[model samples]
Target: MSAVLEKATFSKEAYKEAAGRLFHNEREQGYKPVGLHLYRLPTGPILYARVRMHKPAAEGVYEKLIRPFFHDGIEWKRGEPKQDNGKLLYGLADVQNLPQALVIVGEGEQKADELTKIGAGRLAGVTSGSASSASHADWSPLAGRHVLLWPDFDEPGSKYVDAIAAKLQVLGCALQRVDVAALDLPHKGDVMDWAERFRAAHDRTPTADDVLALPMTKAVPLDPPIGDPAEIDVWPAPQLLSAMTAPLDYPIESLPPRLRAAVEEVHRFVQAPLALVASTAVAALSLAIQAHVDVKRAERLTGPVGLFMLTIADSGERKSTCDTFFTRAIRDYEAEQAVDGKFVIDNYQADLAAWEANYNGVKEKIKSTAKAGKQSTTDLREELRDLEHDKPVQPKVPRLVYADVTPEALAFSLYKQWPSGGVVSAEAGIVFGSHGMGADSVMRNLATLNQLWDGNSLTIDRRTSDSYTVRGARLTVALQVQAATLRSFFDRSGALARGTGFLARFLIAWPQSTQGYRLFKDAPDDWPHLDAFNQRIADILRLPIPTDEGGNLVPVMLPLSPEAKDAWTKFHDEVEVSLRTGGELCDVRDVASKSADNAARLAALFHMFSGDTGPIAVDALENASSIAAWHLSESKRFFSELAVPEDVVHAGRLDAWLIEHCSATGAPSVSRRDAQRLGPVRKREPLAEALQVLEDLGRLRVEQMGKQITVNPALLEGVAL
Candidate 1:
């Protein structure tokens, strides 16, 4: 019993091979129904068998039945085992040509035998579980002097034979089809079913005439040629001999017109490769942006956070094809929908269409139906203005305020809403900041993105083409989440600007691939800040940190007093008027000079504080120290260190030098009084105060390129020489 079982199990490998053949051929067409199982092979080989689950049985039973042919050479693709009778599907092997030509045209072991009886070599059959378009290609190298194409006797079978015939013709083989008529003569079924039919007929000889006809298919006739396909790329060849057969003395300008045209054509063909080379180089370089990229004299900027939104969309398609696009769209849809829904609830309360349909009803109700009386939209909007959100005033919600925004600016439109859970949306709050309002949606999104970030760091075994690898985690989830998108956008295109503001503050880029270039086309936020975000990436990616003037930090002062704001606005207005009126009278050079002066004035204001000239001038000293360090002509290492803002330091050694020639009791220098600690003169005026401080300390804030300096007394406070 054991020997018989071993032999039977050893032979099962052919069946497993047939299953694998069916799998690879079929799975490519998408239906992958089979699992895997360890099965016995005909060579006493224990191997993985890809089986389709056709009947229900205990899971591990098939492995037990086929365990007898165990061996070591066969590799396994370890997968889930099929149950029941283990209807094998595909095999577990890297597809290759078998040693012997096991020409399998599938049915079962019996049908394969029938095929062998006629023209037997190593005849076999792989099941029709998958699309067999691959049979011709995969079997080509294996098709020795013998080749067969036997399929189920049907229309599909005929087409299969025809396809194989055309395909084999390329390999110098005439395909033969397996017709089933001869196999049916045995009994009621095919060649494999010949056992029952053998009992009906007195025929033991397995030489069936029609069985041989199965392996035959003629080549398809070619279409009559109109022109060769090569005509598309055809070019003229070299002329070995001229009409004279000897080298003619070619004239500088006397060549015949037809021959010249031919020569010109030849010249063009000759230069084509060179042109292609130059074109490719130009294309590669064009993607790199070239511009006058000095940011405020090359200062490293770390300003307020700038946000960018990119909507990756196809011009004509209904939806995007990016991975996880649907989920992204759903979020976008929900956000935009929330905005729209809020507008409706606040303004219409009831649907506009429904109201319009009942416009007569509203008017009718104004007289007969109920409370309040309003008709026109102007009045309707005003009436609903008070009823924006849920009433009865829920606690903790901040009241919103509104302002009319135009195409150029973000509208500061605010309204009051009861608590939607103490949500203090900066956008919905009273400070709907200038054009800065639109970034609110993306901001709220980012504040929540940290939750989705997984803390894994991936260590790649091999280097791939992709540059940014997110530790061990996938950026896909982060990208799909709220903040990753905006973060990526700003990091990409923030360097590009329309004037100073980014186009994205007004528009969005493509959502999925808003990487480097895609983010740049148009931006609407703070372009400098957008560009600044990329500096953070240099550290993360281990590349050199890109410095703008070596990371210059710009400190902008805000107006603490209403008067300063008013003064600023007026000054700005006057500057604008001066430029517009004076510009017309001057030549282009004169106009440019005036513009430069205006720019200087604006820069001054941009760096000013509301504390009059005192603090602004003192702060100006710190600025001058930094400015001097950045230049080629006035670079100073010690002065550069003065830019560092700190709490406290040394003083005794510097103090001794300040009060030289002073007597201990009531001491007075030749020109000044000596005190234990004498602070610099507070000149009250901006420039004077600035200079006195700088004289005592080591740095000064020079306003214009070569103007008077604003100095800080604090730098000299605790300094030791």
Candidate 2:
């Protein structure tokens, strides 16, 4: 005997007891009682057995129970298995021989078995375990086949069929819905019920022709109903992208003591979004300390401590105020340095003038000696070479902040003027909308910034101007702009911004506006926290910048402690899993790929800014990981929103409106005319486009009957129609 038969034995006494408890009139029911049923693979080996009862042991309990079995080479070994890809639909093997035949999907295994017996060679039948299991089962066998959904006469059954339809649609199946209402069956009826009624009236079992003759409606195709199909065919529905709700608030507690106090104080004084204040303050801190150290994440992985932050908000939100407040100390340090270096500047000018005069005199002597053909011109050439070598070198001044500058100009400044600086702007239009980001210069400038972010050397080769190479340079870019301007930038840049990973390097925040809730109050009596914060910034700025003799930044390397390294490794592996094909972060893989690195950089900044000594600690890495994870989620939300077409966004809005409207009024659908006048999208053309998008997504169906719009059963699964 097979292993299945050897393990499972028929229970005659249990069958008798179940029949007595379940059926009242066994003789008149006209069907023999069978207690044991085997669930097998399509190739004919039993996988498991289910013992059936005529009714449940108690109300609200299952009528069938599964018997455990051992299965080698599968995730499921014994007991109830998970309803995943390992579990195939019943009757799947029977349809493999008939590749082009029609398949009927029903609710349970019993119903599927009856249909398969009656289908003979004409059709096949299958069920994904139960109504709710449709999403979990492997549906690849039904790909490219004709599928007819025969749901029960109730709402849950309808939802089950719709769920199956969704999977089948993705598999490229030709779909149709069987109209159970036309059969005039009672509530919660099934095909088995109809067969029993037929036996009562005609004294015989119903044939396959009787069930095939039932009514059904074909699903609408991908083409829109009215326009030329080619017009909309070019735009297919996006894969694995969905609308997201607002992200959680920024984790203010993650910052160190001094930084947290400053952020809280600024938020109180400015009454802006807490996130805006925190992000600006973090960027300013990065600017002050990035040139001092490089964070070592692993043996071979080391990167700069610089950060690129972008904040999106509307006008009148105090973005400028927040930026000015955080950067006040850096600006003050620049002014103080310029005042203290006046004498040095004057001496350099005098030295440069004297050197220029000596260089010209030597060139004249060389020319005259060559013209006279005297002394072979060797001594004069040597004098000119020495003069060239002793040219006056300009002093390095402290000019660390810039705004409204082109990328080329920024590169030049970093190369020739200073090795570390920032481009801080409240109105980001001066940066994103400037000529530097125009069609011709956008790519080159983006690459330049990306190179700086990675701490790699940048070589700027200019044809009409001076050529310079920037090594070990660091930059912190913090910008706040309105949403409309950012969207316009995305439109102009096409795919270059995200395609080249320029935007991926940025930590973005799009916080909800806190406008009307700002009820003004008197300022605090003493600004002790803000005062201390400014003092720390000034002290860090006054520290000597680590640099080589060639004027290139050479920063101290900060390694992670053993515990910190273990924590970071776990975080990195978790993010890596989410970058797989169907994971949540799959669409935004670029941003997720860099999140761990950013976490390490943030940890270094916290370590240096808090005046901590030695290696990075576990607490610092934990705090930084929390903040970095929040920004990663924000990236997923905004990037997905930015990539969606305008019409599809409108469709998402309409979908919400429909759900509310249908649930409030207890209606299955709304008329097109009413939707036009009373919907979220009022204009006719836009509404039409939005509706077509919804239809293509299987969220709703448009019927010619009064041009009515009926939502898919899956949308309002539990609610009454």
Candidate 3:
């Protein structure tokens, strides 16, 4: 023999590629090789390989490779290595020696070695002997640390990760899923494949920094359930549109013939968006009749005859113009009434002075008689009683509308002008940002408005002003404001309004802007359609205002017809169904809660405007239901965006930029360097922070191959450029 060598060895470099390939293969197959060895007979060639295991090996290439052999003319066979009772995770010891090291768990020994190589010892790479044996491994070593799991892209591997995930969760390890799919890997690809692809494209392998930068999605805890199956329902993540650029479209056809024609004519005349003009028209109509009309839902139930409406739009959207156009009739009517009221006010003042003088004389005689110790005359006492009973009834002013007034002032006006009135404004700041709507007065103000919306009598007992009560009155409200101001309102007073039912009373609209398309077109002299619209408004306004014998307003009660009632009942039931568990409106239950009442009110308003004296019709109810559906859809979109977290909002902006710039160019990913430099987010730190948050949420990935940062592929799905 050349030598009686006691050991056989090979240079590590000779099998490096093979080892790398083996690592990747094991990872793909859901097996963790751990520490594998190529054994050999002393003084000879290779004998068999042994892979570290938590259980005895069954059958594989390692088992097949073992066979009897003759060494130096002596009979030999595969040798059985002694099992160690206190085995450790492959690279745990090395990792433990490093201060503040991050650890990654992969499937195979080669994968762990590759991770160690890539991380340059800063990463502790370990694996359980095999996928099936993952639960048997000593995971206690990784406890109290943030651990990342790199599972192969296959069913078996996913199952393995899931199994270990439950154990890891119980062991108190924080886990993240490093998704390679975002890297655009081939089907059944692993980390090795990703690295190889990166190396092939960039002429260098990905380093630990690259792996560390990959986006991570939170690993949902696999906590075992402890409840009946029927009682447990898993909630999947809700799918939402990436953005909402337009409001839900209202059903114009649902309007009655004249109203529909008026809306169309105004839309043509103004050359403004139909949504804006149509909404304003509805507001004007409500102002016309809400004070005099009421809907009798049941014998005991009555809805506020008026509507509370809010329209949101960007600046330069002709909001002011629409308000002026639709509400012109109300303004003209109020002007005429103002002119007529002066004479009545003067007469009332004289009459009140005379009554007071007469009453004082009677009171004086009674007091003198009582002081003289004589019985008061029956006629004098009766005169005093009559004076008190006929105390000059204050003339109810014909004020149909008020704007930019405080809550207290509005209440007083309503008390003075019985039956109905409205608060109308083109700017939301007149309402939401008014001094009366400040934090201190928010609750009191909203409570007043809420009660007004419910057709309940209101009492405003202000310490600084005269106390007053509004009885049997209806209040309509309509305002148009920029979207941002509305959001600010939501931040400040929306919660309280919702809780107090003030916000629920509004039928909100967020319409698209019609800024660029407003061509200058003159209307024919005295357009009859315009005249007809205004005339209809005038007719409604001229309807006699009703009051009880006590001078309190009385509403003309309108009942829903039998068929209409059935339809409304069915609609209410449907809405109730949506407010239940697992329903679409669950997130928007506050708005949904009042939708039926709003619908009924709309039905009544529609019936009145349609010039129908009979009970509310099925057609009217159906039309109102359609409008309610649109409002509900719009509210869902608006409220969802309103609730987006600040950080996620930034991410959304970035997402929009990515879709427009990168995704549209057939390149779904971006270099972080490019993103920071050329991204819509101008500042470096904010962009980085936003990217980090997005990565955590699995919306995007930030990676580093070398000095350059790389964003992953398809960062935004279903988003248009």
Provide the clash count, candidate 2: 0
Best by TM-score: 2
- lDDT string, candidate 3, 1-721, tens digits: 1232123234334333334443343444455444454433322343223444222256543311111111111111122222122123556654566547677787655577788778886676766534444543456767777778888777645656665566577677788878756778767677677778878998987787888899777775544522223532211111112332224356788877787888888788787667678888888888898867788776687766688888776566676787787788888998988889889989999999999999999989988888897775788899899899998877876787777898777888778754578888877787888879887889998888888888788977778767777888778898887666776777777578777777777888876545544779887566566567788889988888787886777878899999998998888889888887756677778888888888888899888877888899998998999888778877776776677754555566565566556645656566776666555455676777767666654445555552233333222222222
**Candidate 3 has what TM-score?**
0.57
Candidate order by lDDT, decreasing, is 2, 3, 1
Give candidate 3 regions above 4 Å deviation: 1-246, 356-386, 462-467, 517-519, 523-526, 645-721
Error of 3 at 406 (Å): 1.8
- TM-score for each candidate, following the candidate numbering: 0.24, 0.60, 0.57
Write model 1 residue lDDT over 610-670, tens digit each, in one string: 1133222323222322221111111111112122221111121112233322322222222
Question: Candidate 1: which stretches are off by over 4 Å?
Answer: 1-98, 106-121, 124-139, 143-145, 185-445, 448-721
Alpha-carbon shift of residue 339 in model 3 (angstroms): 1.9
TM-score of 2: 0.60
Worst 10 residues of 2 by lDDT: 232-241
Every candidate's lDDT: 0.28, 0.77, 0.68
